[model samples]
Target: MQLLEAKLHKIDRHNYRSYSSMRGEYTFVDFDFFIDTVQADPYAPASRVRARRKWALTDLAWLKDQSQDYQRAARDFIARQFADLSQQENGIQIDRPGQVILDRTAVVFDEEGIELRFRINLPADDRKIIAKKAMNLMTFTMPKIIRRSTIARELPIEEMKRHCEAVEDQVALRKQLEENNLLAFVADGSVLPRLAGNVDLPMANAIPFECPAELAIELDAPHKGKIRGMGVPKGITMIVGGGFHGKSTLLNAIESSVYDHIPGDGREYIVTDESATKIRAEDGRCVHNVDLSPYISNLPMGKDTAAFSTQDASGSTSQASWLQESLEAGAKALLIDEDTSASNFMIRDERMQALISKKDEPITPLVDRIALLRDQLDISVLLVMGGSGDYLDVADTVIQMHNYQALDVTAKAKEVIATHPTRRTSEGSEILPLPRTRQLNRAALKTMLEDGKFRIQVKNKTTLRFGRELIDLQALEQIADSSQLYTVGWLWFQLAQGKGWEKQPSKAFENMLNDDWFRTMPHYGDLAKPRAIDVMAVLNRMRKADFK
Candidate 1:
């Protein structure tokens, strides 16, 4: 084992620090016997004892130590000799041999932020008999222990090292994420288009802009080694995972960023975006209460008397309806959720566009309205989603939120491209054209919140100040009759994440259509779990309410 360790240290980049140890046996007889047994039957003996090429599984295992394993040998054999023959054939020496090692790495699953342990693999075929034999035995041991016990699942350490290397390689092929920029969070607006559905950045506008690739944050922050920020990519970045996996808390951290942070949010996404709005679901819909029954067909002309307040009105637009108009009036970015009534990619597309298609159309659709504002008006939209659609097909980037973490599908797409070079694109495409227009109004978004305040700092000195309107939390309590309380809460939470949520939740549904931001939210894709259902229904209601 020490000699093998010595050999590995001699190999560049795959070496673990070595210290001389006298614990291992110096004799070759027992070691050879152990080796011969493993070299034959890795799991069971092929023949009785003393038979040529026959060995006992027990004899080989009894010789196994706490560290060395059997599966290690077969894996090393597979890696160095069998793993990357195609790479070698293609002139890429990505694999040496399927070598086994004790190297380790911790990988974070999506947004739930679960840290899964993985073994690193080395490419060398030459390995000590002790280590190789142990790993093969583990392949059997792992599945059993996982189902019944809390034991750590043993992975081919060499495989982990190789896979981690492969992960970097896959990330390298993508142009948007830099090597140094990777394994961390990115908050740059330029990266926004990827999440925001390939929407172009607003140039020469009221809002300052930075390219996604140009913006840099770190994965490790404050007391750790420097790296780019964790991903909180723009467009509607969603955090999804199983229960107790931290989805609502993920939203909480984002909400923290919108206001003055005392401890500040630990989430990399909010820290990076220099956000525009954070909205909660409790706020009712923001929309114009024009008699929709005339053009909107089924919608009732329910006039507000004691129910809807005229005091805090942003004019005739109700929370849901005004969003469509505000976005048309020009709001740079908007984030809402499944809490609205939006659903399915193709269905939403047809209905949403119908409503936004010219005034007086009987069937109204939010998608068409949003598109009009995005293409014709230049407002970007960001709303949450939970199912499939034309949205996914048209999405510039799809962020799969398995856990609490966020990974741009653009990253995943690049991975598929790397393994299959024959595949279309292995890298991020060129920057799309966007009209550099429209200044971000942080004050407007905050005024839509409870005691929301705005502070802007540029070039180290000049500061712009904006004040927010006090939200009547009591009104939230009073408006139990409204359909958008959750929608309001959701939008508020989004704004609080440092981006700033300006419109009421209902407005988000109306605003979402015909806009770029609507294109980015992660989709649950028709799954009806508790967390996803609570969120998706809210978004759908707000969306459907517009056409109704």
Candidate 2:
């Protein structure tokens, strides 16, 4: 602590760049502080720092003995606490988590103790450092925040326990999906609708979800115990309803349920398969060497879709590419919403099929292949369809969401198919081939970094700036946080260290994202663990990437 104060005092009123000399470790009375990186200008990014306290001193040593998931939740809870505490101080800031609790690097636990990784703005007047202000913020305000967050007594003990238990319960429920033969589970009382299109919070007076008697199943939570929810079976399931009837809302909840929500977030008890991917029509997105022959083939002028590569793809082509890419990255189930999907890609009506004969038409819609995906590839699909009944023929489970409540309409859908049968022939091949694993060129990633001076920036959850390329990720609905994107960029950086092509990029990423995923990356608090499928999905959107 004295060393930090002396360094600040020595640079009193000096230019902001002079504070760079303060980049080093310092020992405080109760904890040890390390200034890892210093900011050059006051307006630049905040200085990186870490404060670690011994487990013996924290009175929270029992956390070290908890399960890995429990410990991760505890760390996340502490980071949220530190963020709340430091909110009153302008200079001190920590990465605040959102509704989902992710495995983040903000608050980490090691054998020795707990460490809080955060940033300090380094108080400055214009371009000059203010020594007293810096001292007050770091030595006084920062330490207090750290201690309050790390110490068990200073925290809301009951609330923290509830938070951790909620997370554990969600994990337990997710593990029950495969055994129950379900793709997703939404608790009977879950609030499916959000406040608005822009907000992610639960609506105040929205109707709670009620599973029909036929679809309800029970799962056991380690803490909560005996959770009753709607079990969306591992097959072709369609959510069908009228406009503004909560069909999309139910699907949205199912998609987001792939990640466990925080307590009181309305969807906390809901759980989905982690490998379920929500894919939609992303127009103008880049596609690299993806096999889209199943959905599209024999284009004009003798074009081939077996190795489709496009800088600007149409809605149907983009949707097809995303589905194939998701499968290649090990997606077990797919979530689709008609509102955001391509009309032609989802289905071709009987009238259109008769008008434009199969020989002349090159495109094959998803309606013909959805069942094949389930039967041949052992993949499940959950779709929200409002305008079409063609899917009713292939749907094994039909759920109608009426005013945020679900009804089992499988029998009704079967009745509809029997009464008003269509003559539209299935356009795609009978067998659905598994997606081929495309090798990624490490040199291509290296080139992207070298061309842009090695920079990685994330703008919310919509975009990522890696090297010189600005990849748009607005269509990836399953990315729980922007911090996950940060980790994705760094993961690519790690992958770039090698030479030649990576044989199986998805498996390689899965291996890297093991229990201690953050250890290999830079010691930054803004990193969160991302799924291997999402990592590969982002890479597929990079226009400069080379895949074969």
Candidate 3:
């Protein structure tokens, strides 16, 4: 406290070097505070003090000792503390201090001992020093807030602990996917619907999901012990049922299961492979140097699809490009819904096949090659179909959603398929060709750079305003938080750094995984770790990306 107080009288607004000199660590009895970021102008809104509070492992062990869920809840609990501590606007009793801030990922447990980022405004006297305000804040006000918010024995941590435990249990369940030969699992009692269109909260009257005995598989999760759920095995699995029968709802749940949820969020135990990607037709999305020959070929004008590049792609072309790019970025499983899929890309009925005549048609529908996706490429596909029965012939397992219940009808569907054959010709049996690695021209990126600095601004959770380009991520459903978006934007800037990023984008992710930036997740605050595929999904959509 004295150290922070000593620098109070020495702040020089004009030089700003006086403020830089004051940036250092100050220790209290229970925790140490390291001033991480110092604002140049103390009066500026962006000009603020960023510090981290580190507590002993013993002090935080109660939060993390039990399960991953408890640790996550503990983080949420601590973050809420700052909010709860806010008495009023411009609170904290300090002169001109801003609201206490904590990033979302700050609560997630890493190897580091429990630490949380904090930001508060330091008062300045005429752009110089406000020694008395600084002294009162550091020595009296700030300590009281920290003591109450963090170390108060009366505070409720148990509820948060249990919540975190439950959340982490879901994560643990997802990690066991490959070992169980399953791509996804939805626990018998999970709720699958949100309250409304915009509200993410689970509906009060939503039906609870129940797994059929035939499809139910039991697993010993770390926290939940023995749990039984519907395990969608590795291969082509189709969810086919009547409209408003929870087919898309179930599929939506499974697609989002790629991210772990909070406790009591109703879909907590539903787990999918972390590498699972939700693919849909995105018309007008940019496609850069992607090989669309497998899904599409022989354009009307004799256009090339081997290295497809389109500034404004059609529905069929965009979905094809999205799939090829996902494969390039190493997607293991695809979650697709017919409602959002391009009709032409999904299937070509026998009547349409007769009308178009195979020779005249440039496109080979997904129904023709979906089986090959599994058989040859080892990629699992989970498709939700309401109008198409053609998928049944190619489906390895059929799940019919009835009144929000999953009924395994593989045998029944097979019988129906045998009785009434569509006789759809298989188009391509050859495996999807490997994605060609791109060599990014650094000059293109450098030309986009402003003032010799890389530019990336996240407009929202689903939009990245990168330089002059707007990378739309509305269809990238798995991005769970705004912090993840912020991290991805910075990550793109990081990828643009140094050399060799152009040669192999996938390899860049692999090498970056070993980097301290990837391991530690630096610069961007509290980030949910995103897959390389998610990053590539955004980049592949960038119009300014120069790929060779």
Candidate 4:
């Protein structure tokens, strides 16, 4: 503390140049603090102080003591503390907790110690520096704030840590889903509904989720001991019920289960396959030479479906291309809701089949090939439907959501299908081609870069402005946080660099996943760990993406 105070006291108040001189290390109780960055101008919101704290090896051993899930929980717990401390500080530049993001680091059990990185507001009067005040902030105020919020015994740190552990435990259970043949799970007592149409927080007076005894399964987790939940098996599964009967609400929870949530967020225990993606119709979205022959072929003008490209695609064609793109990205399970899906792309009923001859129709619809996706491609489909009974014949499990309760009606649905069989003729190509590597138009994409750095800008939660391209992510329902978008932006920046990106997009993504800087950056802490496919979605949607 004396060392920091002395350095601050040595600086001249009016000489703002002294602010940069204050960048160094200071020793405090139980931790070593290093000032990694200092803001040149104190009055500017951009002006900031970045620091890192290293704790004792033994103190950290407990955090990384358990499995990967435990480590992720502990890290999340520490990040929560960082946010709380920043909010309580009341410091001039350091009060915003939003800037404190723990790195989205992989949970490893062999860690020797834990280090937390945070940014503080370096106080100043306009452009002039306040040396003594700065000393008080660094030496006295922030230390106490960090201790009380982070290391002190007063806060419910243990309970918060337990919350992260529970969420991670749920995430761990999802890893065994493929081997167990389960697509998704919702724990008993989980609150599924949101507060309202606009709000995302758990709804007041919402119904708690209870697994029907018929489909309830028990799994042993590391932290939560034994967990009993409703398990939705693989293959084509449907959630059907009347309006506002929790059909969309139930699918909403399942799709969002891809990322771990905060403790007490109500959906914390919900788990879905990591590769599960919500499929939707994206009208006017750009498509680049994707093979859509499986769903649509023999166009009216004789346009080729096998290497299809479109600048402004219709609802059905856009949905078909998006499905093929998702499959190319290695989707294991697809989450689809009828409300967001294209009517024609989902089903061609008997009436429609009879009305239009096979030669007259170019579209095959998803129903015919959905079974093939499960049986041949080993990909599962979870669809939310209220209007269609045509899907019952292909459904392995049908869950009826009535007033927020799930009823396993697979047998009843099958019986209905047997008694009233649909004479709808199936239409689809036999083979679904896998996605191949795409060659980048490096010159056009490089135009978006600035002075060797890709100018990545985030417009909002629903949009990402990458260079001149506006990638629409409104259809990507699983991307819940803004940070995930930022990570995607960075991934595009890497892709735009155009060096060593000529290989398969998946391979390039795997290499980026292993990069040291990519793995440990502060941006990673804010990330939800999107799959390579999600990253590819951004690239595929880029309007400026000139692929060879």
TM-score top scorer: 2
TM-score of 4: 0.87
Higher-TM-score candidate of 1 and 2: 2
Candidate number with the higher lDDT (2 or 4): 2
lDDT tens digits by residue: candidate 2, 1-548: 98888888999999889999998889998899999999889888899999999999889999888888889899999999999988888898888998888999999999999999999998889898899999999888888888899888899988988999999999999999999899999998898888888889999987888899999999999999898989999999999988989898888898888887889999999999999999999999999999999999989988779999999999999999999999999999999999999999998988998889998887899999998999999999999999999999989999998877889999998898999998888787788899899999999999999999999999789899999899999888888899999999999999999999999999999999999899999999999999999999999999999999
Clashing pairs for predicted structure model 3, backbone only: 69-164, 69-165, 70-164, 70-165, 439-502, 440-502
What TM-scores do the predictions have?
A: 0.30, 0.99, 0.85, 0.87
Worst 10 residues of 4 by lDDT: 92-101
- Estimate the overall C-alpha local distance difference test score of candidate 2: 0.92
Clashes of each: 155, 0, 6, 6
Candidate 4 per-residue lDDT, tens place, 360-443, comes to 988888888888898888889999999989888789999999889999998899889889988888787676555555665555
Top lDDT model: 2
Quote the lDDT for 307 in model 3. 88
Q: What is every candidate's alpha-carbon RMSD to the true fold?
A: 24.6, 0.8, 4.7, 3.7
Native-vs-model 3 lDDT? 0.72
Task: Give the lDDT of residue 296 in candidate 1.
Answer: 30
Worst 10 residues of 1 by lDDT: 45-54
Candidate order, TM-score descending: 2, 4, 3, 1
